[model samples]
Target: METMRLSSSFTKYSSLSSYSSFSSSSSALLQTKSKNFISLKSVFPANSIPNGNRNLTIVSASKADDGPQQQQHSPFWGGESFFRSVLASMESVYLNKNPTAKAILERVHSVDNNQICYDHLAFRTFGVNGHGIGSMANFFLDFGYTQREELRFPEKKLKALWFSPPSLPVSDGGSGVNGPLPRIFISELLVDQMSPQAQEIIRKCTEISGSGNKHAALASALGSLTWEKPLYSEFQQLARESEYAAWTLVNGYAVNHVTISTHHLKSQLGNIKSVNQFIEESGFKLNSEGGVLKVSPDGMLLQSSTVADSVSFCFSDGITESVPCSYIEFAERLILPQFKNLPEKEVREFHRRDGFEVGSADKIFESTSKEQLTRRA
Candidate 1:
């Protein structure tokens, strides 16, 4: 096995040839959260792993700042190693697809000493052929994430659910290093609700591609499209009916957006308003659908996002055109009314407003809409 070191406390080790071959023997590790190092182990049954040249990279985050530290933290459901690997892969692919987001993240890191923490990760899918939230939810649920609230966008013909991640160990004395993990927000378009023509187009593509649930967990991380590229005509027809459907057609399970937890920033850019201003001043266009700053009805959650970056895509017919890809979002979860009396230093993850707001999220989805794209153009 070969080991590769990544920035921060992450380390990657490659061994297996397929994600399916990766299984856990215990859930002990998922319950153990440490402030030091996390141990990772792989026990492959004889010949269970394929002989291919493919590499299954297992990544784990170590908390030691001095040098590489090794401590046993059981490996179950692939443990944190598998979880971190998935997150790292998604981020890598997302950054590669969105240059505007990449540059802004770099700037934010330079100012915050790379203390960046993700607020949540979003994904889009078709609510047909068993490829919706249920397919992706298992991957997180196996590793200690619990399903939260279900949000609906009736006007947009979409429904979504957000999952809360396992709480990290507070043994670090609330240093804010290994804070709460990012939540997962997954939304799916109601394919049956689309026009007959649009429905046929989607059904044809899904049938040709087959159900992608076999390894749906790795789809986003590997940046692989589960379905064949759609014809430009089909894409256009779907777009006329629902832009969300069109976007998901080409993007597949790839990340829709990764939000920056502005409150987690250790610098002056630690609020949504300041972060939005910073991004706009940095030459990136903000999604102006409902306004640059979207505040929750209760005013406890504030959010904003960059317009989706347009990337050149070659259609199934060999015609290529620029289409919206992914975007970056910024969010600030204000301290809950009950926790407002707590001292600043004592505030923790639970002290702030949690989950998501439908009204704010409804507008945030426009980050990839044509209206927002036209503003970018």
Candidate 2:
């Protein structure tokens, strides 16, 4: 609902003419698109501006609504949370017609809270990270739709949803720490869906990154994210083959690996059949199953069924690591806790490891075997 402005997005070093002449086929690697328009008969029926022929619309929040309505949402917001509803409003309509959004990712060599906030906004589509698409976990699971633009009923749309944890909180006045030193969670989605080749490239990136080889994976991914083809049927056929992974998470708000594994993440990994293969191939040694990742009184991943295993992800260099099963078991028993043998209860209760040092490798890996095992993942 703000005034539209021209954006000087980052472009290739080559001339604009060169980019324009680039091929539009993503069968192999390569890429390069908006959300607006409103119609009850259309996809994004909320906050879309009217354009007669094209599926591009920009509807103001005020105009999108018909009458004065009471806003009913959680007041748990700490002035940092963003809550945009795609109700039968206009904004949702626009994004629906053009689900594609431009993504820009950076190493974030340093802390930038403002940038982190902006990045969260940018992830309105695509996702917060490779974890999965971003959405209000509970709400969208109840009302979200997917791939309907390409697939038919009882298939694309479902009771699935996504989640994005809160941005890193500021721990002020302790050990001389200040703003944005250890909090960043921004995602940059491409303006177009990646081609099959691009998907393969990302897969390779995941593999290479997992293996601790990132530079090559980054180059490969950047060069292969094109979506210029018009093979809807072909893509649909591939989709029918199905190859993705799905893991479970407990809560959407907590960043703890135990609580962050939302259902959306599970489906995004690999499809149903491929997931089965991956599980068997990877020899998934779940800490606790039956869909729980909590810890027990005995200090294990399970405790009288009160604890369960949940999964999440974090990528560095090029590998996107899927932290599966009970994070408690992984972080405490398998992975190092980065302390002088301090217990997790003490670590958490005292709010120690307040900087970028806690998530360091020394804290994440236990032994040579564990490190090697993680790399193979």
Candidate 3:
């Protein structure tokens, strides 16, 4: 929400025309002639999480009707210790791959306690119960996070949910810090929906994973992958049919990416555009699936991300090869026209758009797809 002044040079280079054009037929169908026109109603609902597959127990502190909600959630949902633990785990891997992020952290931490905070942490998981989306959600659900929105991508055969971390008033909510906290976006690959061959490859990976002690296999859901890696040939075959399944099977329960909230970071990095320019100039590649900048149809949310970093993946053949891991994202949210008069700080808290855009997210997912990876290779 903070205003950012762009230097003349960066401003000149940051035009929307500079980004690539999207070719997906779905995107073409959704595009409007006017730059500002976006179909919001079709893209995002007030707060709709698909009812059938979700088991949302965490309730927000702001909701007034505490009747049924009071009975459903845990009293020990979040605390400082648990919050730190999760960030520590994510930072370990994120920092290693993103030098720009690492430098930003160092630069900020040297001055005050205002180090970079994540806008969201994304995880890739299977559709199964204990070792799938449910398992990852349990970790946050137990800490007072409530599911906010469910996004379904039939084209990609993916279903994802975004959970809002608890607010301060929630007695057992996140980190004891009151304010905008990062969301947890967990997506599952609908393996059963894939072809028989793709399904079998994923099934084999999961079966091999579950063959161990039940507790251990369950633990691997959000932990480092424990199953033996699939052969590169198997990976390639699955990649041809469903990249989501192939990525999940290889990097089970891995953190897909860490997002940086531009609204929160504008005071430091100028804006999301500036952040993207800085990262690119610093030698990181931005995902060009949709474009370097993915603006919502309504233009409320603007997002861009670095392509996934190549990390070592040991295959069934016992050879370790570099494959996609994770990357950093920058998001700039605009104040809704209805609340444009509010103060910048207040606008961020009160009006900045929250929740993921299906179109933008669909393209964001390509950050790790075989197409992008193959291009990088």
- Candidate ranking (TM-score, best to worst): 1, 3, 2
1 or 3, greater by lDDT? 1
All models, RMSD in angstroms? 11.8, 22.4, 16.4
What 10-residue stretch in candidate 3 is worst by lDDT? 36-45
Give the per-residue lDDT of model 3 (tens digit) for 274-339: 777766776667888888899887787889987776667779798777766666677887765656
Alpha-carbon lDDT of model 3: 0.57
Candidate 1 lDDT, 55-105, residue by residue in tens: 112101112121212112122234554566566677777878888877887
Q: How close is candidate 3 to the true structure, as a TM-score?
A: 0.72
How many backbone clashes are present in model 2? 43
The local distance difference test score of each candidate is 0.69, 0.21, 0.57
Error of 1 at 337 (Å): 1.0
Flag the better candidate by TM-score, 1 or 2: 1
Off by over 4 Å in 3: 1-78, 97-115, 169-180, 211-223, 266-268, 374-377
